[model samples]
Target: MRVLVVDDERGLTRALQRGLGAEGFAVDVVHDGDSALEAATSVDYDAIVLDIMLPRRNGYDVLAALRDREVWTPVLMLSAKDGEHDVADGLDLGADDYLTKPFSFVVLVARLRALVRRPTGARPAVLTAGDVTLDPSTREVTRAGSPVDLTARETSLLEYLMRHADRAVGKVELRDHVWDAPGEDLNVVEVYVGYLRRKLGRDAVVTVRGTGYRMGG
Candidate 1:
């Protein structure tokens, strides 16, 4: 496996190169964030070992840029600052894993192996259907670049439909999953569907005659 090591510490970088090379990994080392970003975008490494402190730009900016450009290569962020907020910031920006300074080399190798073995197709937090977008984390929805306010039930219902976009979802199935209970009134599904259609537009949710509904304009 190939790995990109982005760190300014020459001794640490050299030691990692030797250790990781011995473990049958082809390692390329870069000393700064700009170089890291350039190398990451130019070549598709199996995984990246990125350090938080670097020249020109920091690791957060580098990882953000990579994700913004749709580069999904797994990243392992390294840092001397082990604060809770620091770790959260790195993860929130898309670093797959994090290691603080004074970490074990053995542990680092194991983490890298685990990261590379993980499935790379982690879904984006946001979901979109045509011009409609839903952020489950924020419980926010927007249609055609405009905010669309929705109640909790409507949000849950729309989220379900959007998740199963292009597929006709039955009312009973919707109730079973999105509603309070499977035994709850099925008419509520129809009511919410109507609410979604009226709020989002008539064509937002398509009724499939005998079947339930599909999301998309």
Candidate 2:
């Protein structure tokens, strides 16, 4: 999918370009807010990565302008500020998602992908993929309207995969987020995925040869 990455840090943007390109995204980058606003208004992008701090115009101003003009492309806001108000402000200004600085590349990708997978400018209460549906509020999972009882750990694993549906999430990413096991063996990831497959059907999760696994593939 086409993505616009807006940031003044050339080095970081370059790294993002290489990484996101490898993950199968067409990335176009702009350094300052004015350039970002120009490119975003001129191009039809699937998603956008907007940093809060920028030269000439700030991200909030650009975002407000986009929303005012009815540009509803999914936007993932970025900033060094981690305050709750800072995040709330971005969302209030029509940001689809937000990430603080020093964020995990994997999580950032997952967050952006989640926004892209959903309807533009909407976040559903229930996440669904084909016949499978998950309710984050109740920790409930159903396949074809039938409840699928799973352990707490299994549910956490399934939740992570479902949140990042249609993307091949790496083992390291899964382990760290789901299991909170930073140094654990990848074998654990394999075993839990196997559990999910047995309960959710073999086709529920697809195994990418060199990558880790993908749900809703």
Candidate 3:
């Protein structure tokens, strides 16, 4: 299978490239988040080994962007941060798996084998509300029959809303899930919700003054 190794450590990456290459993986290496993002979006890699704290864009940003674009290739994040919340943040941001720095190459290989062996995270069938439809697998959203262009963040937000179409989803919830905000300030949610409305029509997402926002009216 193909793999992308993203880390700024040239020496380690070279070693991994040789070792993983010997293990029968077609491995490509990138040194920074910007390069990682470009490679990931263009190539259909079977798996990815991403390091956090990358220059340009960090691992979290790259992972979020990939998920937002609906590219669900399994990811194994490498980071020096071993704190519980750090790991939780990676997982919450949509990483398939994570490895702390100084991890054993053996363990890494084993984890990659397991990840490639398993089926990807199960995605729900295409979601529909009123005239809008969303296909999670393709990250495709359509209003009526025509296509709509949405940024990565916009798509992620819309997916969350559509998944819970039955009730109101509070702005805080949206921030926590979509934006990964740590503080109480949630104006970003409102801004993105407005962005979604622009693409999905003004009435796409309903705001609950006292509660939160919900899918459709």
Candidate 4:
């Protein structure tokens, strides 16, 4: 999975990247809200680790913009402020979950895993397109009843494509939606698309020529 970590505290961001990477996530870290918003806007993240206090834009503003733009990627807010109102405000602004700072990394990991396992919050925990099935709750993928093994990036990409199934999602859209901004240059989109094709099979995603890519039978 790909995760974007936004925190003004450099140490915490680095620690998160290191720890989450060790846990098998492709992690990207950024320090301020401007870069944070840019990253969030431009890349695809399985989930975002955002802080309330930030430079240029507050986490609330960033969260609002994301929702306003219809970016539904789940967000896990991390902040020093643990006041009831602060948590409520984050939730109200469309954050999927919240965690106060000085937290246990174990809890953070658990929360992230939960988010991955249930991206849509639906009870059955299954998503499908054609013969493909993704069980977010189980981190499992099956196509025509056979298992498909995907690397973290491939899984994140496939999830994004499936979430927007049948729509011609442009490379720029995929880039901004799937990969965190700073860690990616323009070519990362093509690279990961190639990765997805290899792992999921050549015809799993279709190129729309001048448009973008679409997922569906």
Candidate 5:
């Protein structure tokens, strides 16, 4: 799954980007509320981790704007203030869940999983295509009920493909969603697709010549 993390704390955002990336999530991060709003609006994130105290706009205004625009992405509001009123205000403004600062990383991940699984038209805990099955929560992939070892990037790529099983996915889309860095070469997508094909069987992912790739032939 993909997540958008909005926080002014550079340390916190970097930590989350690393931790969540290691957990097999494609994470995009922005510091201020304006960037947060722009990113959230442009991308279809499975979940959002929003900080209340922001530079340009606060989390409340961000959440209200998203709701006003009819964006239903699940949001987990984070704040240093653990007061009941603060929590209630975030929820009232349409945040799906709330977490106070200085919280446990384990607890934060658990809360995120809970929010993602709440059936907001988000992808399921497990994704399947043909004989291959992938569980996002456990970061496990199985083919014909047998375990498949994959690098973190491979897991993210396969998940993206399986989620859009119906049509072809272009290299640009894959690069944008699966990769975090800017100025990455599009050839990386081809390289990883080759890796996946070798592991999952060549017939598993078919190249569409001029287009990109599809899950099955």
Candidate 6:
């Protein structure tokens, strides 16, 4: 799934982007609320990690604006403030969850999974295409009763394809969804699709000539 991480802390943002990307998520990072607003407005993200304190606009204002604009993407607020009142305020601002500073990485990942697992939320933990099954929560993929081992990037690609299975997914869309921007100059999508084909077997993914790619139903 795609996520937007909005934090003024450059180090934290980078770390999260890298870490989450490795965890099979497409991540975009912006250091301020304005840029976060712009990106969130433009793209469809699975969730947003918004910091409570920000320049120009606080997380509360940003969350309020998103709701006002009818962008109902789930938000997980981050703050140094751990008081009950602060958490309540974030919830009041329409945040789905909150994480205090110095939180556990494992716990944070679990929370993200919970947000994604909500049927009404953006990301989904389970996805299927024909006889192939993928479980994002467990990071497992099985086809025809056989387990498929995949690299992190391959897993991200397969998830995207399965989510949009039976539909034409162009190279650009794949790049946007699976690859972090600025995308690689090479034909990375084709390369990874080839890798997945080799790993998952030839019948798994189909190439649509002049279009892009798709997972067979």
Best by TM-score: 6
Sequence-dependent TM-score of model 4:
0.68
lDDT of 5 by residue, 1-217 (tens): 6789999999999999999888767788899999999999988787899999999999999999999999999999999999999999999999999999899998888888677766465557788899989877777898888898999889888988987889999998888777775357999999999999889889889898899998984
Candidate 4: 10-residue stretch with minimal lDDT: 175-184
Tens digit per residue, CA lDDT, model 6, 102-149: 888778777876786672754456788888888877778999879999
Those runs of model 2 whose alpha carbons end farther than 4 Å from true positions after fitting are: 121-217
Query: Each model's C-alpha lDDT?
Result: 0.84, 0.82, 0.81, 0.80, 0.88, 0.85
Instruction: Name the regions of candidate 4 deviating beyond 4 angstroms.
Output: 1-4, 18-48, 53-74, 81-86, 89-95, 109-124, 180-195
lDDT over C-alpha atoms for residue 20 of model 3: 72
Clashing pairs in 5: none
lDDT of 1 at 32: 94
RMSD of 5: 2.1
Q: What's each prediction's TM-score?
A: 0.56, 0.57, 0.56, 0.68, 0.89, 0.90
- At residue 185, candidate 6 shows an lDDT of 48
Which regions in candidate 5 have their CA more than 4 angstroms from the true location? 113-122
Per residue, candidate 4 scores C-alpha lDDT tens digits across 41-139 of 887677899999999999999999999999988999988989999999999999999999899998998898788656687524576878888765455
Candidate 2: deviation at residue 148, Å?
26
Better of 1 and 5 by TM-score: 5
Q: What is the lDDT of candidate 3?
A: 0.81
Candidate with more favorable, higher lDDT: 1 or 6: 6
Compose the digit string of candidate 3's lDDT tens values, residues 80-163. Answer: 999999999999998889999899987898788666644364434677878888765456799987899886568767877886
Candidates 2 and 3: which is better by lDDT?
A: 2
For candidate 2, the per-residue lDDT at 118 reads 71
Poorest stretch of ten by lDDT in candidate 3: 175-184
Which candidate, 3 or 6, would have the higher TM-score against the true structure? 6
Q: What is the C-alpha RMSD of each candidate to the true structure, in Å?
A: 16.8, 10.3, 14.2, 4.3, 2.1, 2.0
lDDT for model 1 comes to: 0.84
Candidate 2, pairs of clashing residues:
none
